[model samples]
Target: MDRKLNRELVKATALRSGYSFTKLAQEVSVSTESVSKWMSGETNPRPGKAIKLGKVLGLSYEQMFGVRDRTLEPQVAFRLVRNQDPSEEHHERAREMGRMYEDLVPFLPFNQFEAPPRLKSPTADYEYLDELCGSLRREMGLEADVPVSLPSIFNHLSDKLQAVVIPVFWGHRKNKAELAAHIYSRKTKTTWIPFNLDTKLWDARFWAAHELAHVYTFDVLDDEAGEIFSDAFAGTLVFPVPIARAAYEELAKVRLKTQKFNLIVEFAKRMHVSPICVAKQVDRYAVAKKQPPVNAEYDGIYAAISRMSKREKTVAEEFFGGEEPSVGQLLEAAANIFKSPFFDTLSKYLKTNGGSPSFIQGLLDCSLVDAKALNSELA
Candidate 1:
């Protein structure tokens, strides 16, 4: 990241991508003058600032600064799949990562499960996905145009789908350098995990939407044959095919930023998906459209209706909305009223394992060996 290249990448990407420094400033929530200073290399960008530029410019710290291994000293950041608990600096990083996830890689499958089956196979379990999707469509009364937040979409399907959302960071604790939100299926909906405490408002919102795509879009399609079907369905439902196509056309003219960054922002706006998902979709669309530098991976996102909706609504009111409830507040809430294990299993699991549970009891409220032993294998 020599001074020369940093300036070149920023200016070229901006001009080619058809973006203004003002837009960059807006993306990072800073002033245009600051962007100017960074472009001129007049002053070093703060760690937080540098990360933003890197994301927007499609470069890394080492690639952006002539200096390698530049120190990152941001007060806060929110990333995908990094920290279990975020520091304020880390939280901001996480949000930044969320923006990337929402805008770029948004539709990429968050498969906590094994890959779906291939097509034309007798093993294809189309019923589950179809029932789940149909149930949601019925429950929400969603027209093709309904613009529900991702979480609301999940809440709508939680109970019947039997799953919940959890946020994860791969390497860091709470920094935006790397964090991701995941949806997990469970016997009891209450047993799902949650986003990190320090996640940003917008990130939380998009995570909800992306997860909802999973809940809704995977139902009617054959995902196992190839992930492309479910991935496309999620993108289509969450973002709508027409809008995304239009946005893609607009972005194609820009050459300043890599298609990675351009598609990330443009498609995210069109469909309101997370940046990461947008990136994933861009990859899928590229391949489907016969392009390169994109991966065509898909995971399914379908579920039952009656249960998911209720639980999701509670999460929207509580965690995402930032309201604290008394134990009684939670207790009085009917078990069946919301998704089975979301709020409860979420609270309990996050408190203990922070999500990576190995035990079935820990993941679901089911008796594993004990139930079987007592039923038939009794001595």
Candidate 2:
């Protein structure tokens, strides 16, 4: 049987519900065009889907088709490659993950997540970035001039920021949107950062710092300025001013181009960041100190670093003991190694709320067979 919705009531309720057209359609397992048609009175939903829609909207059928009421957009900070926008599919998947975070918060073992205080009138200027990074490093009990241990940083920030760190094996092959995602659920007031564990661990560290910048200064909607802030913040946080100044001083004393390149490469190796990150930071430091910038071109440095980075294992590979791991092993690694409560939370949600293995597959973005195996283990 089909149930006809009052078009005006549906539109009003959907708007008041604060769900985007895509998300609303997702929650109801329908196409956005179908949602559009239903809201426009061009179509009606089947009885089962209609009931599901009402439940997802937290309203009884009488209230959904009869009455209307109530609001928050998720703040999405995608760490995309330069000049690239994630595909709509990627955005939809990220939003679904955000929805899961919203559903899982009540079962969290700690207090409600609180965002770190936003910077007042934050600027992306070099001086401001340097000072902010220095202060943050001190707060994290890290030495300003030494390379940071990513494991320490991860553990510290996970507890300090009170954010969920979800490590995902998006794919073994890298893509533009493969590093990290920062999604803030306004409804839950929680920040959910999902790290793509397919990239090199060095790249992951830098990207993690970038997301940390987003978490700390997430005052308003993300914009170009916010991205600028995050990029600068990540570089400075990983390679502080003191370290950059020292590297600059060392490079200044070197006259040969190869010597300078070697110095930069060594700095990158020591810092566990890309050569471009080290090169750019040193140039920025030189400019800030009114010194001549390093006289090296970066055309070849990129390729050289790319070849060098292939030797390192990604976060997931390391967690799984450097071989293709089973789905169950991946879930265990996510829990025991990454210390992520996401799987446990999902397990509890399934047991209490009565869900299927398909829910696990969707939330973890895994195969149905793997999800079933994982479900039995979680059960």
Candidate 3:
């Protein structure tokens, strides 16, 4: 390959790896100047150094030279708050997971489906956003006002939208609150949304809706406003305007502010959403209805809910009989795809090399013992 092409590939891989040039240079046993030159297309590494660099970036020698192999390229969209900063490690891990998904896709049973058209503008009106969600719900044969079933939504997305909804256990625990991610591959025309399973069921469902909003409107929104729009769209999708208004009105009838706490809990349970989400939705409903805001009282209600000792298990847990699906479930869902000779060859290679356990552990974020168990299960 030409020096310029090699440079571009190196830069792309480095960005995906979330590694600085100096750090990558140290890993490859090259000087910072040499790495800079390689990136700038002024110099090319020796064959031995190039091989080492490829290994560090998890790329094959051909891939390092800008050759197009069968690997998939995934574009990731994170659903994080504006103020939060994701560490480089987080970025790299996300990319790594994307690559893993890419490898698994060819084995999965995927249908070709197109996502909804992107909104023309990032600041689409609330009514328009609401209509979008309603349209989607109707398309999926769901009632606009009813609480959505998570598993049902997952199946619809997988079957009709050609999207995969997977619960990932790999992200940083501290960032679990804001760790939803959507990965879209233009080449494969598929989408993957992974929610952090560590969160409450209500929050997980909300995050799922948020990621779906992104999938529907990603091309139209600017980076900053996309998050805001997706948040609004998700809340509206999970709790429609009419339902939210009725909920707020019911709570408003409670004469004492303190008495409304129980009503809030009941409303949340009925809506299948967290109390915090209900509180925020109530605020939004109030704003839309031109009613006086109940911010202070809702804060108190939230605090009271937090003080409770035991909380109810999420709807998902109850529906699944307290057994949450894991990476094994995902693999099983794509079982037919893995029956290919490629996987058979790879499995044999790993087993012969005694690398099966470590590979499984790393890929699924399991401990060594768990990985060994998984290997046995697969065998």
| Residue-by-residue lDDT tens digits, candidate 3, 1-379 | 2223366767887998898999998999889998998888776665456767878988776676655443555566775543377543444345445655555555555543444345566454667766777887887778867887666556555665566665444433344434567767655656666655454566666777777677766656756677788888878878877777877888777667666667766767777877767777887888777897666245466557666514655433543445645545535433332111223333554556555675665444445676686677554
Clashes of each: 93, 1, 1
Can you write out model 2's per-residue Cα lDDT over 1-379, one digit (the tens) per residue? 1235876666677789897778999999889998887887786664445667777777666565553221364667676644377664466456656766687788766565444566777777899888888887888788887776665556655667766777776664345355788888877778878888786766776888887878777755356788888888899989888888888999889877678888988888888877778888988888778998675445576677678777877777666666778767777766666566777877787788876776776566655776788788775
User: Per-model C-alpha lDDT, please?
Assistant: 0.42, 0.73, 0.63
As for TM-score, the candidate ahead, 1 or 3, is 3
Worst 10 residues of 1 by lDDT: 183-192
Scored by Cα lDDT, where does model 3 land?
Answer: 0.63
Ranking by TM-score: 2, 3, 1
Name the best candidate (by lDDT): 2
lDDT of 2 at 19: 79
For candidate 1, what is the TM-score? 0.35
Candidate 3: RMSD over Cα atoms?
Answer: 8.9
- TM-scores for all candidates: the values are 0.35, 0.75, 0.66
Which whole-number lDDT from 0 to 100 does residue 204 have in model 3?
61
Best by TM-score: 2
